[model samples]
Target chain A: MSLSRSSAIPRSALTTMAASRRTVLRGMALSGLAVGGANLLAACGGDDDSGPSSGSGATVKFGINEADGSGPAYDRLKGMADAYTKETDTKVSLNAVDHNTFQESINTYLQGTPDDVFTWFAGFRMAQFAENGLITDLSDVWPIDGLNDSFKQASTAPDGKQYFVPVSYYPWAVFYRKSVFEKNGWVAPETNDDFMALMDDMQGKGITPFAFGDKDGWPAMGTFDILNMRLNGFDFHMSLMAGDEAWDGDEVKLVFDTWRTLLPYHQADPLGRTWQEAATAMGKGECGMYLLGTFVVDALGENGEDLDFFTFPQLDSSIPADSLDAPIDGFCVAAAGQNQEAGKEMIKWLGSAQAADAGNNAADAPFIAANSGASTSTYSDLQKKSVEVVSAAANIAQFMDRDTNADFANTVMIPSIQEFLKNPDDIDGITASIQEQANSIF
Target chain B: MTDIEQTRAEAPQQQRAAAPPQGREKKLPTRDRWVVITMVTIPLVLVVLLVWVPAALSFALSFGKWNGFGDLDTIEWVGFQNYKDIATIYPPFWPAIQHNLIWLVFLFLFPTVLGMLLAVVLDREMRGSRFYQTAFYMPVVLSMALIGFIWQLFYSRDQGLINDVFGTQIDWYGDPDINLWAVLVATAWRHTGYIMLIYLAGLKGVDASLREAAAVDGAGEVKTFFNVIFPVMRPINLIVIVIVVIESLRAFDIVWVINKGRNGLEVIGALVAQNVIGEATRYGFGSALAVIMMLISSVFITIYLRNVFREERTR
Candidate 1:
C-alpha cells in the first residue's frame, strides 16, 4: 500500500524490466529536475548588502539591459558607461544582461544585490520600484539642463520624488515609406473620417491599410493606447492605466468598438505575425502603413531610409491629438547598492545633456535624447520628426504595459487584449473580465 | 580451515586489542563505517532538500499571497483564495487543464504507438535501417527551443513554406483551433523520435529464440508479436507508458515558445510560467497551479507504483 523508494527496487527484480525502465525513471527525474530548477530560480533573490563598498578607489556596478550583440542599444549604453567613467574618474562596471531576462528578473534583481545604477523604463514600472523602496530617490538630480518638465514628470514617482533619470524616448505612430506614399499620392490622415478614407483608398489600391501584428501581445497595446488616447483623452487613458478608471466603462468600450470597425483595414491574421514581420510587409509595399514605435526602422533595415510617420489621427474633435505613447527609456539607482553615493552621482551625470550627447555621438543609430541640449546634428529625419511630435504633445503615455502594475499588465492585460483580438465581438465580456481581474490586483 | 579462516577466527580478538576502552559491539572498520554513513546520508539529504522541500513549499505557498519580493513577512496568508480564483475567475485554468489532457491522450494515441511501430519495422535489419534510425532520432537531440524556432519557419502565416508549397493561407500558429494541433504536431515529431529510440533498444534486447519458437509453431509475424513477444515485453510497455505520461505532463517549452500558452495552446506548466516566471510575480496563484499539477502527477505516479508493487506481490 506504501508508495516508497524501497517499493521500486524489488519490482525491478520481479518484472525483469528492460533497460528502458531506467529511461522511464530518467523522464520522471527530468521533471523532478524541472521542479527543483524552477524553485531554485524562485530562491535566487539577493541578500541585503546595503553597506558602502570598503574599497580604496570609488567604483559602481551598472546592470545594463542590453547584451553585447544587441547592436546600437548596447553601443549607446556602453557609450554612457564610458562617459561616466571618464567624467568621475571612477570605474563603472557594466553587467550586461539580455533585455527580456533583465526585465523578467527585475523583482529578484532589485531585491537581490542589484547593481548601483540599472537601466529601466519610466512611468508605473519605475513608480512601483520607488514605492517598494527598491530604487533610490533621485530628486536631487533635477534641474538637469535640456530636460523639460514633461521628462522630469515622467521620472517622478507617486511620493513626489524622482526615481528615474531621463535618457531617450521613442513615440509610437503610423509609419509609412515616403516612396510608397509619394507613388500612391497619399497624404497623412488627420481626423477619424480622413483616416477611414485613407484606409478605404489603400484597400481599393490592393494594399492592406495597416501592417498589424500581435503575436507578442504587447505590439497591439500600442494600437489600443492611441485609440484610447484619441477617443477618451490622455487623462482618462492614464487613469485607466492606473486602474482608477474602469476597463469595462463605456469609454473603453468605444475604443474597442472603433478598433473592431478598423480591424478589416488591418493586416489579417495579426496574431500569427511578429511586429518585425509586419514591418517587413510594410517595407516591401505589401502593406500601406504600420502603427509602431520609431524602432520600426530596425526591421525595415535599408528601407528605413524612406520611413516617415504621422501621429495616429484624432477620433474625437474635443480631444486633441496631442497625446501619444512615447515610452521613455531611462536609468535608475538601486536602493541596496553598496555604493549609493557613487550610484546617485552616476545617475545624475546620466541625466545631464552632456551624457546624452556623449551617448548620442558614440552610436550610429542614436536615440532621440530626452535632453534637448544634446546634439541634433546627427539626427535622422525620423529622429527629428519624433522630437517634434513629442515636444508638441500635451500629454505622454508610457504605453499600456509600462503605465500599469507589472503583474496586472502581464498576467491580465496581455491575455485579455489577445482574447479581444481573437474575438472582437466579445468586447463586453473581455472588458468585464479585465475589470474583475483589475479589481483583485489593484 | 585455511590461513585466512584462522586469521578471521582471531579478528575479534585483534579488534578488541586495538580498542576495548568503550563498551561496543563489533563492527566494520571505522573507515568502512564512515563510508557507509556518508553514502546513505548524502542521497537522503539530496532527496529531502531537492524534492520534498520544494514540493512542500509549493503546497504551503498555494494558500498564501505574495509578490515574491522583499521578505517572508510580506507574504499574506490568504488561505484558499488563490485556488478559488484560479478555478472560478482565471480564464486560462480550465483551458490549460483541457490542453494538458489532450496532449497526454494525443501523445499516447499517435507518437507512442507510431514510435513502437517504427521500432518494429526497423528492428528487422532492412536496408538503410541505420540511416532511418538516425533520421528519426535527430529531433530528440535538438533542444525544444530550437525545434519551436525551426517549425516557425514552416508555420508562419504569410511567408511559411507550408503556405508557399500548398497554395493555402492558414494561420498555423495564430488560429486558436489550428495552433494547438500545430504545436502538438511539432511536439510529436520530437516525441516520436524519443519513443522510437527507447522502443528500439527494448526490441533489440528481445530474445531471438522466442520469435523463432513462435515461427516454428506456425505463428505469423503479427500473431507472434501479439501472442508472445508483446506479452514478454510488458516491462518495456510500462516504461513507454511512463515516459509518455511524463513527457505530456511536462509539455511546456514548445507551447510557451509558440505564444506563452495563450489562445488555445494553454498547458498547466505554461500557465504557471506565465504567472510566475516573468515580471509578473503572482506567486500564490502560480504555486496553486504548481500544486495542482503536482497532485495530478502524483495520481499517475501512485498508479504506476501500485501496479509495480502489485506485480511484485504476484511474483
Candidate 2:
C-alpha cells in the first residue's frame, strides 16, 4: 500500500494541474484580449447585455447541473443561448450534467480542472469550498457587473468575499389546486389564523390541507423555512440560523407549533415519497396545497394540473415578510480553478442579465435570475406571483439546508425535524442535540 | 504503472524496432509472440493508468485520511484511527455493524429456506415450473436503485398497494421502528429468486434414483428429502450463503436511496458512505468503517473457503 501510494503521487489526481495548464494559459491570454473584445461586442450589438466578452475564439465553458433538452424549459434556454451566441459571439460551452451526479461530478471536475463558471448552492455549502480556496474570488468583477449593495453585504460570508454576483433570486411558496380552492370557496389568507380556518374548511370538505414528501428530507426543511419566516420575520429567521440565537426560543417554538398543528391536515404517509410525488398529489388535486419552489411548475406541467400560488400567512401585519419561502441556488467560482480569469468571467456572466436568462430558460425554470433591476420571470401566474413576493420581500433567507453548516444541517437540523414529526415529546432532547451538534461544527 | 507492466516487452521492442545499430532481425515465432504481447500490453497499461489506478487510489482512500476532494498532501495520517473507531470505540459505529450483522443473518437465512423449498417443489415436472423459475430470476437483473424505489412505493403508508390490498398502512423506510423489516423484505424479495435458481441447479444434479430408493426402503416423502436430497446440496448451499454474506456486507444503495439510513436501518455500508459523501467529510472515518467491513467480510469468506477446502481435503 505504501509502495502504491508513493508511485501514485504523480498520477491522474495531480493531473488536474497538468490538464488545466493550457486552458488557464489560454484563458489568461484571452482575458487580456477580452478587455478589448468586450468594447467591440458591447459597441457592436447594443441590445446584447452579456458582460463576458465574445468575439472570434473567445469561449467560456460554463458548467451547469441542469439538463438542457427538448423540453419547453430547454427550448427557452436554447433560444436565450442562441441569442447570446449571436449577440456577443461568445460561446458558453453548456456542459450540463445529471442532477443526481451533479455534486460528485462537479467535485471531480473542479479538482481535475475547474470550469470557467459553475452553478453553486448559496450559504455554508458553498462557503466551505470557498474557504478551502477551491472556489475563486470574484471581488474584482462584482462591482463591474453592477450588483446590488444589499447583496454585497449579504452574500459576503457565503462567497468568502463580496464576490458572487446575484443573477436571479428564486422564492418558495405554497401552491394549491385552483379547482380544490374554488370547490371549497376557500381564498388565500392574509394571517396565520385565516390560513388555519381555510385549512379546516378544506379538511371538512375531505381534502388534505397540505401535501409534502420527505423522501429527500429537504421538503420538510423547506416547509420549516417558510413557517419560521412567516411566524417570525425573515431577519429573525436568518439571524437565528446564523447561530446568533437558539431554535428553542419562543419565536422558534411558534414555528414548531405551526408544524404540529398542520401535521394532521398533511397527507400523513408522505414518509417515503419524493418531492415530485408529494407535488404530484397537489397536481392531481389529492391535496389542497404543496409548499415548494418555482421548480414545481415543471411538475405541475407534467401532471397537466392547474394550480394557484400563495405566500405563507404572516402573523404580524406591521413587519413585512418580503417573501414567505426560502430562496436558494447561486453560482460560485473555484478559487483554485486553473482558468482563474475564465472563472471570473463566468461569474461575471452568471451575474449578468444573459446568464440569468439562460438559467431561467434551462430545462426547468428555477425562477428568474436573482439579479436586481429586473423581474427576470418566465413562469406561469402562480409561479410569477411567488417570484413577485420574493422581489417585494423585505428580506429572504436561503433554505436552511444550504444556509447552515452541513454538520448541523445533515446531523442536527434534518434528524431533529424528522424526530419532531415522529415524536414531538422529544423536543427538549431534540433541542439539546441540535445545540450540541451546532457547537461541535461552529 | 505502464513502465512496470511493459518492461518485459517494451525493452526488447525499442531495441529491435529502432536499435542504435540495425542488425538482422529475428524471424522466429518466439519473437512474433513477443511482438503480439507488446502490442496488446499497451492498451492494458493505458486501461490501468486510467481506470485501475483511480480505483486503487479509492481503495487506499479506505485506509488514509482524505476528504472526497482536496489537496494530496493535506491528507492527514491518522493510522488506524478510523477502523478502531468503528470496531471498538465509536457510539453509532458499532450499532451500524450490528445492523449489518442482523442484515446478513436475515439476508442469508430467509432466502435459503424459501429457495430450498421452492427448488424442491419446482424440481417436480409441474406444468408451470419453468415460468416460476423465470419469474423468480427476474429481479436479479434490476439495479438496486430501481428496486429501492419500488419497495419504497410498496411500503408507503398511505397510497401503497400493500395497504390497499391488505387493508393496513405501514411506513417501510420512513417510520423509525418498522424500517429494518421493510429493508429486509425488499432485500429478501430480490435474493429469494436467486437462491432458488442456485437450488434448482443443485436439484438438477441430485440423483432421483437415490430419493426413490429411500422411499422404497420405507421413507416418507418429507423424510426422504431431508435425509436424502438435503445433504447432497451442500456445495450449492455454501455458494448461496457466501453470496448473501458478501452482498449483505457490501449493501449500500438500497439503504442510501431509502431515506439515507434515517429509519434505524443504518448499516455498515451506509455509515461508510455518509462520512465520505455527506457533511462529515471524514475520510479516515469512512476508510476505517470500510476496513472493518472488509475484515468482517473476510472472516465470512475465510470460513466459507475453509469449509469448501475442508470438503476437498476430505475427498
Candidate 3:
C-alpha cells in the first residue's frame, strides 16, 4: 500500500500541478496590480483637475509629518487642507511622511526639495531653521485674529520676526482620576505643604503616590522642567536650557535635591515601564496621580471623562507657580519652496478659528486649539480644564527638548536625566558631567 | 562531433603558433582579454567606491566640526578636539566599549562551547535527533529585531512571562547593574542556534574512518572527538571564531530596538547611530566614534587574516 501511494503521485504530474498553481497566483497578482494602479492614477487625476479655483491658480505644497492613511491626526490635517482649498482659490497639495522619518531627516529635507509649508514645533527648533535661512520670514502673516500675545511670542524667531504660525498646544500638569481623588477625600493641593500631605495620605493608603516612567528618556525631562520652574522661576529655567547658566550651579542643584526627596513616592523600577503602562497603573487605581500632558487620556484609551488635573502647586512662596510647559505645534513656510506667497497666505488662514473648527469637527480626538476664538463646545472636560489652566499661566515654557539645542538636549540631557533617575543621590556628579558636555556642544 | 574533433585538432596548432613569440605561454584573443579586464575592473571600482571611499571620508570628517547644514567649505577644522571630547566628556563611550568586550567574551564562553557540544551529541544519530536539530536551529532563522521583541515578552517587568511565572519584580531590561547580562542571555538564545548549525555542518564533513581508527585504538568517545575530530576541523574552528568576533563588533539591532541603547544597553554601533542617524546632526562626533569602531574591528580582522595566511603557507 505504501509503495502504491508513493507511485500514485508521479514527479512529472506533481510538477504540472505546482506550475498550474503558480500560474493562477500570477493571474490574481496581475489583476490586483491593475486595480491598484488604477486607484493611484485616479487619485493623481483628481488632485490635478477637480478642485474649484476661487482665490488664485497657484498650488502650495504642504509637507505633513503624519503618514497618509494614519488615523485622526492625518484626518485633522487633511480636513484643514480641504477647508482652505474651498475658502481660497489656491490648491493645497499634501506630501505626507511618517512622523519619525520626517523629524530625523528634517535637516536634509529642508536643504533639499522641501514643500512650501510644513508642520513643525514652535521655539528653538523653529528658530534654528529661521537662523539658517531654511524657512521664510512670515511677519506679514502676523497680527492674525484670535491669536493672543503669548501665541505671538511663541511664533516669533530670534530675529524678532514671525517665522511660525501657532496652531494648537497641550499643557503638562499633575493629572488624577476624579473618582480616585474623591474616594480618598483628596482635593488638588494649593501649596507645597499641602502637596506633601497629599502624597503622604496616598502612601498611607498603600497606593503609589505618582505614576512615573522614563524608559524612553524624554518623560523625565517634564519632571525637571516643573521642578526648575517652581524652584528657580521661569526666566532662570529658560536661560539654563539656552546654555547661558552653568548646569552645576546652586539653582540646578536645588531642583535635583527636591526631586530626590520626592522619589520615594513614585512607582519603583520606572526604567522598565513605558508611559502607557504607567498610565494603566493610574487608571487601575494603583497610583494616585500622574504628571503628564493631557494626551495621557489617549494612553488610557478613554475620552478623559474621569480625568482632572491641576498645575503643580507652589514649591516656593517667592517664586509663583504660574509658569508651565505648554508646547505649541505650528507651521512654517520653506524658503526654498517655489510658491512662497501662497504658502504664507495658506498659513495665515491656517492660524484662524475657522481652520481650528474644521480640524476639530473632522477628527475623533481634537487638539486644544491655540486660537482663543476657537469653539470650545466640542472640548472634553479635561481639554477644557487644560485650556483654562494654560491661558491663566503668566509664562508658558516649551518643553525641555524643544526649547534647547537639539544636539545637547538629545545626547547630553537625555542620558544625564536617566543617570539621575538610576541614582538620585549623585546630583553633583550628574550635573558636572552635564556641564562638561554642554560646554563642548554650546 | 565535428566541432569537438575540429577543436581538438586545432588546439596544438594554436598553442604552437602563439608559444614561439610569447616564450611558451599562449596569449588570449583581444575580445577574451577585454572580458577579463572588465570583470576585474568592475569589482575593483565598486569596492573602492562603496567601501574604501566612505571609510576614508569618515576618517577625514572625524577631524572637522560640521552640523551637515552647508557645503563642504563650511566645515570648521578642529583637529583632534572631537576625539578629546569623546574621551573626556562623552559618558556613554567607555561604557559602550566595556559592553562590547563583554559581549565578545560571553559569546565565546557560552554559545560557542554549548553549540559544539550539541553538534557532537546530535552527530550520534540518537532518536528524535532531527527534531532536536530543528528546535536548536529555529532562532537562527529569525532576525535579531524579531528575537528582541520575542524576548521582550519574557523580560518586561510588569507584563512579561518571567516575572509572572516567578513572582519576582526583577527589572530585566531596566536596571543598569543587571540589564547587560540580561541582554546577553537573550543574545545567547539566538547565537547558540547559529553556532550550532555551523558546527553541525563541520561535524558532518569529518571522515568516518578517522573516528573508527580512534575507536580501534581503544579511544573513548570524548577522547576520539578531542584527539581526532576537533583538530581535523581547524579551518571551521577559525571560521566560527571570526564570525563570533565580527558579530559582537556589529551587535546593534537588538539593543537599539529595546531602548535606543540607553540605560544599560549602550554599544559602539548604537552610539554611532544615536549621533549620526537621529536629529542630533553631530556628524563630526559620530564620525569619530565610527573611526574608533573601525580601528577596533581592523585589529581583529588583521589577526584573523595573518593566521589564515600563515596556515596557507604551512600547507
Q: Candidate 2 - CAPRI tier? A: incorrect
lDDT of 1: 0.83
Instruction: Residues A149-262, candidate 2: write the lDDT tens digits.
Output: 656654576534754556555567778777778877788887778888988887887878888788676678888887777678777877777787776667777777767777
In candidate 2, residue B263 scores what lDDT? 45
Q: Write the per-residue lDDT of candidate 2 for residues B1-315, one digit (tens) a residue.
A: 222234434545676768545344644488877998899999999878654564455456556655434656677676665465455433346567778888888876787689778888999979999999888888877867678889866777666788788998666667767788788888888888888888899999876766766767888889878877776666687787787877787767777778776646677766655554454455555555655666676788789888888966654
- Worst ten-residue run, lDDT, model 1 chain A? A10-19
For model 2 the local lDDT of residue B42 reads 97
Q: What are the lDDT scores of the predictions, listed in order?
A: 0.83, 0.64, 0.84
Evaluate residue A339 in candidate 1 and report its C-alpha lDDT on the 0 to 100 scale. 76
User: Per-residue CA lDDT of candidate 3, range A235-325, in tens?
Assistant: 9999998899999999999999999999999999888788888899999899999999888988888888999999999999999999999
True contacts recovered per prediction? 0.42, 0.20, 0.42
TM-score of each: 0.89, 0.77, 0.89
Q: Please state the CAPRI-style docking class of candidate 3.
A: incorrect
Candidate 1 C-alpha lDDT tens digits along B1-315: 133234434756787778766645667798989998999999999877556766676677778777765566677899998988899878889999999899999999999999999999999999999999999999999877678889999999988999989999999999998899999899899999999999899889877877887788798999988887777678899999999988888877787777887887888877777777667877777778888888898899999999999986664
Which regions of candidate 3 fall more than 4 Å away from where they truly are? A1-55, B1-26
Top candidate when judged by DockQ against the true structure = 1
